[model samples]
Target: MGIMGCCSDFLQRVKPYVAMISLQFGYAGMNIISKVSLNHGMSHYVLVVYRHAFATLSIAPFALILERKVRPKITFSIFVQIFVLGLLGPVIDQNFYYAGLKFTSPTFSCAMSNILPAMTFVMAVLCRMEKVDLKKIRCQAKVVGTVVTVAGAMLMTLYKGPIMEMVWTKHVHPHRSSAPETTDSSDKDWLKGSMFLIVATLAWAALFVLQAVTLKQYSAQLSLTTLICFMGTLQAIAVTLVMEHKPSAWSIGWDMNLLAAAYAGIVTSSIAYYVQGLVIQSRGPVFASAFSPLMMIIVAIMGSFILAENIYLGGVLGAVLIVVGLYSVLWGKYKEHKENKKSKVMSLPLTLKNSEGNGEGMDIKDEDEKGKKANSMNLSTSDDRSTIKVRFPIPEIPMKVEAPNA
Candidate 1:
């Protein structure tokens, strides 16, 4: 029983990080598929509409089953907040992001999105979702990590550098067009696409902070994700109707478009949102966003291998920096969490409960008596809410006797 309890506790402690890794893999897969679909003449607006519509359907049953009675009432304010979340996340963020992907490569899109952790950190601090204590080493590490992540992302974008080795290049892909449809500039529209990506990153960061605040009230991850998807579908549909008036543009004739929509809706949107929401609720917006760089790394490798994309020297260097930043930020979070845990344990009062249902308070003082060091304090509360405080006796340090010189 003790062993099982310890195992359960350890898994629970690491669950958020596990979910984050899974979430990044899903996002990386979506990016690769969505890029292919966009290249096949699927409009970004139409794609978002279909993706969210499918996501809403996929998530609805789980939400209903999991949080049927436990879900909180959707107040008018909360409804509005969810609507705004839908706008920022699925509507504006996804739309602009896909459009950027069409202009750029999946690798570049993920690289640009690396700016999210830094943006989320700033927004989290501003929104009070996360604390910033510059005096502490943990806080300083986080700040430095965020800076390094952003710098690495920019470096990847500005300089492609030289070509690195790739295993995929050795294998000949027959019937596959060796020449890619995209280029560095010109028809690719890098500047316009990059601007859209920047806006999308900002929107995503804002959405993270807002979602964290909303979860405090809503408390149901599945329900909140469902509502956001439903609202996003409506918002995306309206935009699609205006920007993509052609009926032919919305039509999917059983190709990469359908596959992309299905994969994104089920794996990326529905499942990813639920897991990401849980992470944000358990940790914070910054912590959840901190894992985004992993997607960049995954996409860089996948894009190069699958899509015959170029792997530049800048990407290698930038990936290394981003990885370092990721670890640094995680270390800081771990340190801060450790400090908080120690403080919490120390702050706890030693309570003793008696047979009667009466409450009693006791103080635990760290007093030095006869040079003895205090070790531990045990608090036992009686069944009747009686508080009995027991002071832990300090352990006496044994003095070492001087050895006779022989």
Candidate 2:
């Protein structure tokens, strides 16, 4: 019996780590394919359009079949939320990501994406979804972690050091340089790509907050996923038509390009998303996100070793900082959870102190006893210093739903 219990405990611990690793690999695969497609001369606008179209086509049928026996009623408010979510994330986010990839290497783009969590934290606070008090260690940790993460992203993007310059000069030599003027023009392209990727990250952070809010109202993840993709496809197609003026860029009939589009749309966007929803339901959102930093490392190594791309020192350090910041936030939250558990265990006495305060003035002995009891109730002597405290009542946890048929 002891051995069985131990094994079950082991499995529980391993599950989240394994899920996070899988999510990272999925994201890494996305970076690789998106980069390769751009290298093959596909424009960013075209890629964005194809991605949504493919994702929508892939997710719609499966979602329908999953909920076919009992379809989820789609309300207007839910549709509005989904529309905004998809527009911010898939439509705008992918557009910026691809544009960034177009100007810079895939590795660079992926590295920049590491700032998403920090951005999400800030945005969540601004949206009044998250509250923190700096006096508390948890809130302080989060603030420091968020600031460090943003600083790391900026270091990777804006600051070009001797190492980066040396690497760029030594390794990345453009073979077909038309003129010095043309070279400067190409440099501008990389800059534009970097800026666009940053925008994408910000948009993605917004999307995350929105999804967290939207999840409250909508019970059907699959149904909402389908609707958003459907709407986003329409929006992206419209964008492509207006922006992509070149005849060659817009001509999408039949080829490897189409296959790439199909793969991105069906596999990466649709099926992968469904898999993500399942994983999130089984585990949680934070567990899903914790694996994302791994994508940066994978993309970096693959780009450097396999594709012979330059690995700048700033990139490496920035990646390290981002990962550090990510785990710091996660650890801070974990610590906060433990403290809250302790508080709840101690709250019974504190509740007593408040409720049992009689109208008649107490004697010194009684008052002293009450103070002692209140002190015992508090696990931390530093309670006065704790400005922010997150109290999670038992009622807040989501009720579990049985998995849909695979």
Candidate 3:
């Protein structure tokens, strides 16, 4: 039982870590597959529409069933928040991200997205959701990590060093050469893609902050996910109509396009949102966003294997820096969490002691009242006996004297 209990506790502790890691893998696949679909001529606007549409369809049933009893009443304010969420996520984030990915390689886009944690951290602090005290080591670590992460992102964006070759590149080279050649993008395109990615990351950070706030009111992860997807689908459709009018652009056959939409919608949209919401609820938005670097790593490897994308030395160095910064932030967060938990645990005994002292004081007062009542009763009995002796003493003496005289 002891070992089993320990295992259970360990699993509970690692659940979030496991979930976030798996989510990164899912996101990596989405990036790779989406890039392939885009390369095959799918419009980003149409992709966003179909992605959220599929997400809504996939998640709505589960949300309806699972949250039937627990779902909160939706107010007008909540509706507005949901609308904003839809705009931020499905509209702004998705479209900009897809555009960025289309302009840049998946690996480059993923590297750019490594700044998400830093962005989220700053936003969280601005929103007063996260507290920072530079005096504390943990806060220092977090601040330093954020700076380092941004620097790394900038390094990746501004510099592209010599391409790094892998062991499998020799074998993979022939296959890529045999495939249709892709036009090389210029430095201007790189900058444009970076800008788009930065905007997308900013929007994503905002979405996290808002989603965290929304969860406080809604408190239903699955339901909230479904609503966001549904609303995002509608908004994306509107955006798509305005941005892309050609009916043929919207057409998706049974190809990479359909797979991208379905996979992204179900996995990254519906499931990711729900899981990330749960994590955010438990560990705040910063913690939820901290795993973005991991996704970058995964995407880098996957993009190389699947897309035959070149790995640059600058990206490698920048990834290292980003990873360092990510760990620093995570360490700070872990230390902060540990301190908070310890403080709460330490305060528990004091709280119990205070309550117990109040209870003891009440008990002492009751005891004192009982003692006074007993003393009063004893005094009253003694007084009654004394009064009886005084009232009956003369008659007893006179009867004794008359008997002696007879």
- lDDT values of the candidates? 0.81, 0.73, 0.83
The candidates, ranked best first by TM-score, are 3, 1, 2
Question: TM-score for every candidate vs. truth?
Answer: 0.77, 0.75, 0.79
**Evaluation by TM-score, superior candidate among 1 and 3:** 3
Off by over 4 Å in 2: 1-15, 69-72, 162-186, 253-256, 340-406
How well is each residue in 1-406 modelled by candidate 3, as lDDT tens digits? Answer: 9999999999999999999999999999999999999999999999999998999999999989988999999999999999999999999999999999998798888887877878888999998999999999999999999999888888887887877877777676755545453345666787788889999999999998998899899998889988988898899988888888798998888999999999999999888877987897787756776787778878877787788888878888887888788778878888898999899988763111113432221111211222332111121123322211111112223444445565
Task: In angstroms, give how far residue 96 of model 1 lies from its true place.
Answer: 1.3
User: Model 3 lDDT vs. the true structure?
Assistant: 0.83
lDDT of 1 by residue, 33-105 (tens): 9999998889999889889889999999999998998999999989999999999999999999998888878
Candidate with more favorable, higher lDDT: 1 or 2: 1
Clashing pairs in 3: none
Model 1, residue 226: C-alpha shift (Å)? 0.9
Alpha-carbon error at 6 in model 2, in Å? 8.8
